[model samples]
Target: MPGYELINNSEKKAVNEIFDNKELFYNGKRVKKFEKEFARYIGSKYAVAVSSGTAAIKIALKCLGIKAGDEVITQSFTFIATLEAIVDVGATPIVINVDDSLNMDVKELEKHITKKTKAIIPVHMLGVAAEMSKINKIAKKFKIPVVDDNCEALGAKWGKDKLGIQSDICTWSFDNGKTITTGEGGMITTNNKDLSMLFREYRDHGHQNNPKFPRGRDTHRIYGFNFRTTEINAAIGIEQLKKLNFIVRENKKRYNIYKKELLKIKHLKLRRIPKANIPLCDCIIFSIDDLNKIKKILIELSKKNIITKNVPDAIEWHFAKYWDHIFKEQKISKQQLETKFLKSSYYLERSIAIPIFVKEELKQTTKKARELSQIIKSFV
Candidate 1:
């Protein structure tokens, strides 16, 4: 029943400056400036700008040398982009289940590790960090790298470490719905110089170094792709980064309001994340014993202009066709695939991400949530 708006005048002005200055290329000054600003915010030695979050993941995998026959362990309940990135790098995705927090189940990871396993991608689903300590220990034991998919978790922290600060390589998205928007952009953060170089080169068509010269210059170096983010996007990103703290504070405030209001409805359940974690999005997941009745109620709410959505499905559904090909190619038994792929440890059937943003006040959203709660209770 509430409303949401995109970036305000301050963000618009930054975008205008990029066009006014006529700097549109990735190698332009605006892009460099934003990269520095983002790296400082994320506390990483290097940040490579790319076109999108999916591109960031693909480049990170490439920089890490994840290739054909490599098994990359990841959760099966994440965005398809996460799995697709692994597959793009010619690596076979080793799907695992998620825990109660909708993060990679550490126990399931060890069972699936093979000699071909090269890395583990621990996604900070809904902004909550996976059990990174346990996952990192396992990765260290197996000599596998960790690439954190932090697209949905811009300012999330676990213990004392920031989400992207502790991994071998971390990726972030600046999509329209994320905590910050660069219109369409992404960033890859890492401390490894060699890996950073690889990502930079890959983003700029395999140029051995910076290519800011005239026509027909020596630009091509190693094998790469065109995944570069423009200065215009980076300029918008710089402005967004400036308001990061404000955005995070408002999101947390809204989450608390939702928690307070939803608690009054006894039959409704909310998804649980660890107390130590800070989420990127406020997801309310519930399970109704009578699915048809709940669907009827939802439809009625929709007629009243109230929106809702199902939480993400298990990864198998999102990547079913891919898994089929993988299973047949590897000649793995159907039973093995089921055990490895079909079982999702944490599956919530009814869930929705209520609106939250920096410009909105918590009191208003809380009141709305309480109103919705009352309607749901009437049905019970």
Candidate 2:
């Protein structure tokens, strides 16, 4: 319940329109329109709509030329999707510690770069922003392309620009819980024409936008996959994008309320959200120790039908250190493994996300939040 969603006549009309139109099926009709709107929304030259955020990351990595033997540098504490995309591209993920900013430690980056370090993926974990300025400067010096894993940070900002614009390639999700939704979908944005062309060709099964081989006919220009969005999803996305600004504004109000109410419970410490960044604030999160105590509080809260997540899922998968699959497969050195324990647990294990969804029935959400806070206070 810690997510925000608002749907009305627009989504219904979108679905009906798609169902009525037998002429416009899925050959990039609605998908292309949504992509154009999304690209314009983020001020990017191009956008390639895909099946999910994971697909966007996969293609972004492939477009960056990361291969099986290459090493990709990314934040240690993030959703497993970041690591999944790295391994999907056959690239070894070199996870580094997150500093107080709750992002990849830029200081640790230079030491990890080598002949094998091909690219850097700065995952903007949670709604909070990652430190892209310093990371980008270091990346420019080394000439390694920075692919922003901006899935969790849609509609987020840093300074005058949006989070995705600073990097070489950026990805977004319109999943059920993201700031925007098309049921399930993703988009990749970039300023580079070559990369844009590659993304298009890759997404469309290497067709190369040729007249000779149309939809029914085929000529494999390059190896690719069917990571395309349907007309139904794109139609919903187009309508959803229209309401994004208002949605963000309303959700910010809800987030502020949560922050104020929860801060009164001082023992359950809340992290100071960064000033330079304007986060989507889709889900309210806080840090707490004593997992058992937190678990007990959650049980009490759930009795009232209130929901909260345990440290962004679990301690093992939430933090990269305990990723047994990557640790076994990625060829992480002994030194990197040794340094993992030395890094500070900045946020992941110590945090819990509370349900703060956007609601038309505002009184109910607020009342529930207050009740959840009181329940949590009792445990403390």
Candidate 3:
């Protein structure tokens, strides 16, 4: 299998510096610096660092006053964290279908809005930006806020604006697999001062003034959780931020290479992205009537040490069997807004994520992807 590695010694040196200083905590100066750097990077007024992407979403929901019985509409075809964050904030997740690009279907979003609807979390799936202009217009008509789940799309843009700048609250992830890595960290960006302050408090355990003091000693402004990002992680993030533009450019280059090579095949279908947007990952998906055949081919590739696996399934259906009781109680319904829900079906058994990272690896991976596409087309 082609190897994939997410770390470089250059990043390790930054993390080492923080550890040398013993600034392992997530409070005070280190966190502030990371937040400022990230905010500037995304062109947002404020950025709050959190332990994970889920924490960032939960904090955003809490700041927005999303509570139990409240409904938050989001794409069905996303990571479970997107829906889980809604549930974490005591709001019901109303799953909406996605377009061909694997983003929330803006036209169908209006159907899900109701008296109980509180917000819309548009996820930029597989690094592709959602149709934010239309989604924002729909949210405005209902007077609901938008929490952009841009976990997969850190450097992605919509028109001239960046992802987080266009929404009320935009959350990003820096997990090991993301475009950028901070080991494990997330960021919440917003222009709303009140929301930004609330998020800071929420991430640090709801302390009013002195976060160091015991719970009852200081003012307990609100109920909160310990979702702060560590200084070590922040340091790693600081370095990661420096390389983000380079990483995004590399990912895009790899995407184009795959697109150029694979488009020649008749049966394979690549994910579509607008020329203006920057994709987060090169996720190539296609349709196949026989899933077992695809699996067999992937296994054969695995023997050669080429890692091939299906794309992830939609959060709703993946968890349906386990969470059916809660889903039924909440009255969550599924909507299909595309000719084929390729997002879910592609994830089920047919699609695979080809290796794409650095320029050198990307070249090799792109060549392999085209070769694999030919292998699959032969079956067709």
* Best TM-score among the predictions, by candidate number: 2
Q: By descending lDDT, how would the candidates be arranged?
A: 2, 1, 3
Count of steric clashes across candidates, in order: 2, 3, 2
Task: Please state the error at residue 216 of candidate 3 in Å.
Answer: 9.5
Tell me the lDDT of candidate 2.
Answer: 0.79
Cα RMSD (angstroms) for every candidate in the order listed: 3.6, 3.1, 4.1
Error of 3 at 251 (Å): 1.2
The worst-scoring run of ten residues by lDDT in candidate 1 lies at: 312-321
Candidate with the greatest lDDT versus the true structure:
2
Clash-forming residue pairs, model 2: 1-355, 2-355, 2-356
Give TM per candidate: 0.86, 0.88, 0.85
Please provide, for model 2 over 1-380, each residue's C-alpha lDDT reduced to its tens digit, 9 standing for 90 to 100.
22226667888898898768773566678888999999998989999899999899999898777899999999887778889999989988888898655678778989999889988999887677787888889999999999988887887888877779998999988887677888899999999998998898888777677678766676665777888889888888999999887776777878887887888885787655556788777767776667676777767866876665435455565577666667678566546664684564545555677745666456765776688788888888
Model 1, 1-380: lDDT tens digits are 01114467877788787568765544558778888888888889999899999999999888778899888888866677887788888988877777566678788888888999988998887667788888888899988899999887888777665678887899988887577888688999999988888898898878766458753464665789999888778877887788777766667777777777777777766666767666655445444445554666576667666554325324244433235554555676666656654445224334444455445666667667777776677675
Rate residue 331 of model 2 by lDDT. 65
* Alpha carbon deviation, residue 208, candidate 2 (Å): 1.0
